[model samples]
Target: MIQELNDEQLERYGRHILLDEIGYEGQLLLAQKRVAIIGLGGLGSPVALYLASAGIGQLTLIDFDQVDLSNLQRQLIHNQQRVGQNKAISAQQSVELLNKNVKTETITTKLTDDELLKITKQHDLVLDCSDNFETRYQLNRICHKCQIPLVSGAAIRWEGQVTTYDFRKNKQPCYQCLFPLKSNQGSIQESCSQNGVIAPLLGIIGSIQALEAIKCLLELPTLAGKLTIIDGLTMELRQFNITQDLSCPVCS
Candidate 1:
């Protein structure tokens, strides 16, 4: 059931309302949307802030890591004061401060497949901001099973990529389609801790993730089956087509 926006919501979202693309009806639609962010780290920071500010009805923030002093450089949702707090809890507080309208669920423990599927079924979309391949593959499989859209991003050492896999749409590529499991050992763990990332690179990638997520929620054009690569060092932007792998273990 759709709830009417109060006077405050009308006033709060006036700018969005002014746009022809997102008039009153679109704003109303956004208020009924639910989004889940799989991590509260570098890439998840801006995604959460923007979605919260945009008035997404509900947000699920999942992160088992705690905020560290080193995380302050790139993770904007956490601050110096929250250095030792769990990232999901810290992010929830940040969202509350940004927009009280968005209901948030904070999860601090790693989720099993059953737990993930249960939560995935409750939301409209999922954004992958995790650091490791294990988490990404897990999210991909669950989202594929649920037939919901997944917007995923990765940033490390001045380079980043963002993509959307809309399992709701038939014949689209999934995450594993783009990066197949090649070796006996999983993909190399090329983390920022091992190789430092520039402060602003995450913002660029995460902002795109947020934008694409909104598009998905709004039923607009998305980057499904496309990978956007951004290089901060050379300032080069490129997009490559991601075809559905015939043997894509998940999507096909």
Candidate 2:
């Protein structure tokens, strides 16, 4: 059943309704969207906030890690009071304060393959803000298997990268196609804990991820099949076309 926007809804989302790309109808479409975010750190923080701000109907915030004092520097969604709390729950609290109309589900435990698939299948899109390759690889496989769209983002030191893997079609290039597990790439874990990312790097990449997600939901042109890398120091942005790896195990 389609829902007519009430007066308060119209007022709350007035800015988005004014845009040509996201007018009243597009705002309504966004309201019907269901999104699952795989992390609640720096990257997931902006992604969740912007998605909620855009009136995404449902959001599932999944993160088993707990927030620490160090996270306050970059993870803007959480505050000093929420430190030591599970990231997903903390993020949920923040989202509630941001938009009452948005529904949020928090998962604090590590998910198994079946559990992850079930959650991913329930959402219209998935965003990978995870720090490790294991989680990224797992999500890539699940999203590809379920034919769900995925927006992946990562930041380390002064560099960040973002891309969308549109799995709605067959033989689409995936995250695994970019960084395979068989090679030493997956073994070399480069995370914020070790590398220390700049504060705005996550924001730049995650914001783009959110925008790409919105574009995907609106059936507009997105960063699908393309990789965008950013250098925060130089402020240089480079884009590369992402093609399917015929010999890749996941997509091929």
Candidate 3:
């Protein structure tokens, strides 16, 4: 049951409501949507903040890691005082501080396949901000089964990428379709901790992830079936078309 915007909400989101693309009705729609963000690190930080601030009714944050002093470089949702706190809880506190009206749920442990499927079924959308390919593959499978839209983002070194998988649409590719599991098997995965990413690089990619999530919720144009890549070194942006693999094990 979506509620009408109160006077306070109207004032709080006046700029969004004023936009022709997202008017009063759109604001109300945003206020009624539920989102689940997996991983509370660099990418999840801005995605959570922007979504909560944009008036998302509920957000479920999932992460198993604790904040470290070293995370402050890119994880903006946590502070010095919160070092050692669970990342999900830290992000929850930050979201509440930004917007008390938005409800937040925290899952501080790794979720099994069944657990992930059950939780994702209850949300309007899912954001795959997890760092590892295993988690990303699991999320892609669950979201495809549940037919939920997924906004995926990744950043390493000076390169970043973002894409959306609208499972509601037929013939659209899932994440696995783009990068097959066999090809990724036994591959060396690089981490920001090892390779080092520019602080603002994650900011740029994560912010765009938030924007894509908003557009998906608002039924605006999104990067569905398209991949957007960013080269922070030369500031070059490029887009590539992604097609569904007819033999995709997950989505076929």
Best by lDDT: 3
Lowest lDDT block of 10, candidate 3: 185-194
Best by TM-score: 3
What's the distance in Å from true for residue 249, model 3?
Answer: 0.8
lDDT by residue for model 3 (9-127), tens: 99999999989999999999999999999999999999999999999999999999999999999999999999999999999999999998899999999999999999999999999
Worst 10 residues of 1 by lDDT: 181-190
Query: Model 2: runs farther than 4 Å from truth?
Result: none
Q: CA lDDT, every prediction?
A: 0.92, 0.92, 0.94
Give candidates' CA RMSD values in order.
1.2, 1.2, 0.9
Better of 1 and 2 by lDDT: 1
Candidate number that wins on lDDT, 2 or 3: 3
Clashing pairs in 2: none
Please identify model 3 stretches exceeding 4 Å from their true place: 186-188
lDDT of 2 by residue, 1-252 (tens): 238777888999999899998899998998888999999999999999999988899999999999999999999999999989999999999999999999999999999999999999998999999999889999999999999999999999999999999899676799988886778474568789987989988888889999999999988898888899999999999999988989988889
TM match of model 3 to true structure:
0.98
Q: Per-residue CA lDDT of candidate 1, range 43-71, in tens? A: 99999999999889999999999999999
